[model samples]
Target chain A: MDEFYHLIDWALCLSGLIGLWFFFSRTGGPLNKAQAYMSVFREKGIYNPSYGLAIAFVYALLDIALSIVIYVWFYNDYWTDSDFGIAHLGRVILLYTIVLVSLHVFLPKIDNRHLRKTINTVDYHKMGLSMAAFVVVCVAVEYWLKRFVYGMWYGEESESILATVAVVASTAWIASSVYTSLNRYESIKNASERTLGALKTRHAPIVFLRSFVLDKPQRKGMTFDEYICSTFALNSQPIVSLSDPDDFLPTGGSIKIQSTDEEWESAINTLLMECRAVVIFEGKTVSLKTEMAKIQRFHIPHDKVFVATPPQNYRLAAWNDGKITERKYTLNYIWNDFVKALDTYGGMHGLPETDPGECMIFSFDKHWNCKAPVKKTGKDFLGYVVDQTVVHENDKCDYISLAEKLNRFELQHTQVLSKSDEKRIEKAIIKALIMSALMSLAVILLIKLLVK
Target chain B: MTPTDFQTIEESLGSLFFILVLIYYFTQLGRLRHRKKLDDTDGVKKVKKQMLWGIPVFIVLFFAMVLSSSLLL
Candidate 1:
C-alpha cells in the first residue's frame, strides 16, 4: 500500500508537469472541441430545448460513470471494509453533485457578465482576494468536515480520502471547463444563426474575408473572428467566411462555408454579388490578393466593401526600474511581406500612410478613394484604450473601429426586427436554457438518490 | 538505489518543479502587467486579473507541498 501510494504521488507529479507544458504549447484543445460541437449542432439543428437537455444529461451520466470508476479503483480495499466505504462515497458524491449543479446554473451567467465588461485593476485585485478567500474557505470546510464528521472512522486513511478528493475535484474542474466552453460556443452560434436568418430575409448577409492568420490566436488569446463577433454581437449583420482548408473545426465567430480549393473562388464570387458589405482584413496570401482582384473586377460599390489595413508597427512604453522608456516593436516578417505584396498589387497606392508606430483601419469608397483612417478612441466592451501611459500604436487595428464602421453601413439598410422574429429567437434561447437547467437538476437528484 | 535515495531524488524533483513553476508564473505576471500597461485592452486586463488569483493559488500549492514534506519527515 505504501509503495502504491508513492507510485500514485509520482504519477500525479509527472502528470502535472506534462499538463502545464501541454497548456502552454497547444492552442487547440477545448476550443477545437467546442467549435466542432457547434458545427454538429448547426448541421443537425440541435439547438432546441429537448436536444440541449439530452446533451446535458449525457454529459452528466458520463461524469458520474467516470467518478465511480475512479472512486472504486482507489478504494477497492475500503469497499470490503464496508463501515466507511459506502458512507464516505455518499458524501463525496453529494459534494460533487453540489459542484455540478452550481457549475451549470452560475457559470453561464458569470461568463455572460465577463463578456460584457472591461476588467480593470481594481477588479483584478478584488478577484484575487475573492479567489484567495474562496480557496481558504474550501480548505477549512474540508478539514473541519473530516475532523469532526468522519475523521474517527477514517482517521488512519485520511491521506487516501484527500487523494481521492483531489482526483475527483480535478476531473470535475476539467469537465466543467469543457462544459462552459461548449455553452459559450452554443450561445455564439445561436446569435450568429439568428442574425443570419434575419439577413437572409433581406438578402444582405455580411461577408468576412481575411488571411488565415486572423483565424489564429495571435498575441490576443482570441481569434480575430471571435473578437469581431463579440464586438458586433448586438448590432451587426451575420458575418460569414470560407472555412480554412487546414481547420478541422470551424472557428466560432463567422459562419463558415465548407468548400473545396477549386470551388472557393466561385463561392467567393457568388457571395460577393449577394453580400451587402465586404470586410477585407489585410493579408499577404496569394488567395487573398486574388480575391481582391476579383472584387475589383466585380466592380463592387466602394461603399459596400471595407478594407481593414494592418498596423505598421507598435510603440510600447514600459517602466524599467524607476524610469519610463519607449520601445518600438520590430516589424515582423509577415507584416513586411504583407506590405510588399500590397504595394506590388497597387492596393497601398491611395490608402493613407499609417503613422510608423500606430494602428488604423482605412475605409475605401468607389474608384478606390480612401477615407480618413479610423483611430482608436473611447471605451467599448473590451476597453479599446484604458491607460494613456502605455499605447498600442503597433497593435493590430482595433476590432471596435471595424465594428463601428460596419454597423454604420448596416444601420443605414437596417429594418427594425418584426415582433414575431424577435420573440421566436428569445423564446428558443430561454427554452434551451430552462431545459438544460432542469436536466442538471434531474442529474443532481438522481446522483443524490443513488448515493443514498 | 535504496528507497531513501529514491525519496531524496523525488523531493528534489518536486522542489525544482515548484520553483520553475513559480518563476514561470512571475514571468507571466510581468508580461501581463506590461501588456495591460501598453494595450490596456479588456482582454489583457482580464488575464492580468486572473493572474492575481493564479499567483495566490500557486503559492498556496507550493507551501502545501513543503508543509506536507515536512510533516511526512
Candidate 2:
C-alpha cells in the first residue's frame, strides 16, 4: 500500500517523457496531425502564426494538466503530515509553468519559413531517436529516484548520485537528438508494400465489387446487367450489382424514406465502409468518379481504384500468357485486368485490412480508437454505422445497425448548435446547464418536503 | 428566509441537488448526441464511452479498498 504511490510517481514520470516527446518533436507523430489540419485552414487564409501557436498551446495545456494530476495526491500528505510534499507540488507547478510559458512565447516566433519547411516532412529516424532518448531518460530517472529514496530510508544524502545519473542521461539524449538531425535516414521506401505482398503470398485476399454503372448503353448493344454477368464468370463468388438508381434506401427501419438525392451521402458513406476496391466507368457522369475519390481520400491504396479512361484502357477480351493475362477490347476485359491489379497491389486473398500503424479500412475517428479489418476470412470487430434502413433491391447491406437517434424536435430549437456548421460538437452545454438547474431545484424541493 | 434556516436546508439537500444535476447533465448529453452531423459522428459517444469505462471501475476499486481495509483489520 505504501509503495502504491511509487507506481503513480513512476507512471507520471514516464508520462512526462511522453509529453516531452509530443512537445519538442512537433514535426512528426501526434503534432504532425495538428500541422496537417492547420495546413488546410492555412489555405483558407487563416493566419500562418496560428498553426505553431495552436500546437504549442495544446502542448502547454496538456503538460500543465499532467503536472497537476501527478502532484495532486501529495496534497493529502501536506495536510496530514508536513510541508515537504507541498514543496514538491510547488515544484511541479513551477515546472509546468516554465514549459507553458516557453512554448507560448517562443514557438510562433521561430522563423516561419524554416518551420514551414520542417513541419511537413515525416522523419521516421527522428521519431526513432526520440524513442531512444525516452528510454535513456526514463532509465536514468528511475535509477536516480530509486537511489535517492533508498538513501533517504537509510538517513544518507544521495543528491550527488541523482545529479550524476540525470546529467549523463540528459547529455546522451542531447547527443542522440543531434545525431538524428544530422544523419536522417532517407528511406523513401513504401513500407506497406512488403506487408501487402506478404498477405498475398499467404493467400489473404483483396477482392472488391462496388457500383458498376453503365449509364451509357453498353458497347455492341449489350445491357449493363448482361456485361456484369459476363464479368462475374471469371469469379463466380464476386457478384456485380445491377442496381436501381433509386435503390439508395437504407437497410434499417428508417422513418425518413429519403429519396435518391437525400440518400447520396449515406450511400457513399456505406460504400466507404464496405468496399475497399472501386471500379468506375470513365467518360461517363462524374458522380461515381466522385464516390471513388471519397474512398481514395478514406486512404484506400491508390491501386485499388480502376477507372478506364477509355480508348486507352478499354478492353474486350483477355488471354493468360503464362506470367501475365493480357486483355482485349471488352468492358469485362477491363474488369479482368482490374482483378489482376487488385490481386497484385491490393492483395490476392485477404480483405483489405491495413497492417498495424496503417490507417484502417473504415474508421471515422481518425484521431483515436482505430481498428483495421481482420485478414482473410476474418471479420473486423469494427463494422459499418447505419443512419437508416430502407432496404435496397439487391439486399446488399453496408449498415450494421442504428447507433441511436436524436430528438430533432428539441435539437432544431436549441440556440447555438456547434461552433461551426461543419463541426458536429453535439453537446449543448448551455441547455444542459439550464436543465441541471431545474432538476436540482426540483430535487431540492422534493427533499425539503420529504424531510418536513 | 433566515440565514440559519437557509444553511440548515442547504446542508441537507446539497448532495441530492448535486446528484440530480449530474443526472440532468448526462441525460442532456445523451439527447444532444442524436443532433450530430453525418460526418461528425461519435462526438458525444466517445466521451460517453470513456466515462462508462472509467467511472465504474474507479468506484468499484474505491469501495473494495475501503471494505477490505476495515474487514481485514
Q: Which predicted model would earn the best TM-score?
A: 1
lDDT of 1 by residue, A17-65 (tens): 7666544333222223233333333343322222333333333344344
- Candidate 1 TM-score, true structure as reference: 0.37
After the best TM-score superposition of candidate 1, give how far the Cα of residue A332 lies from its true spot, in angstroms. Answer: 2.9
Measured against the true structure, the TM-scores of the candidates, in listed sequence, are: 0.37, 0.26
- When summed lDDT is taken over every stretch of 10 residues in candidate 1 chain A, the lowest stretch is A109-118
lDDT of 1 by residue, B1-73 (tens): 5678658755765766565676566556655665454333653666667777887887787788767766665
Which numbered prediction scores highest in DockQ against the true structure?
1
DockQ of candidates 1 onward, in order?
0.03, 0.03
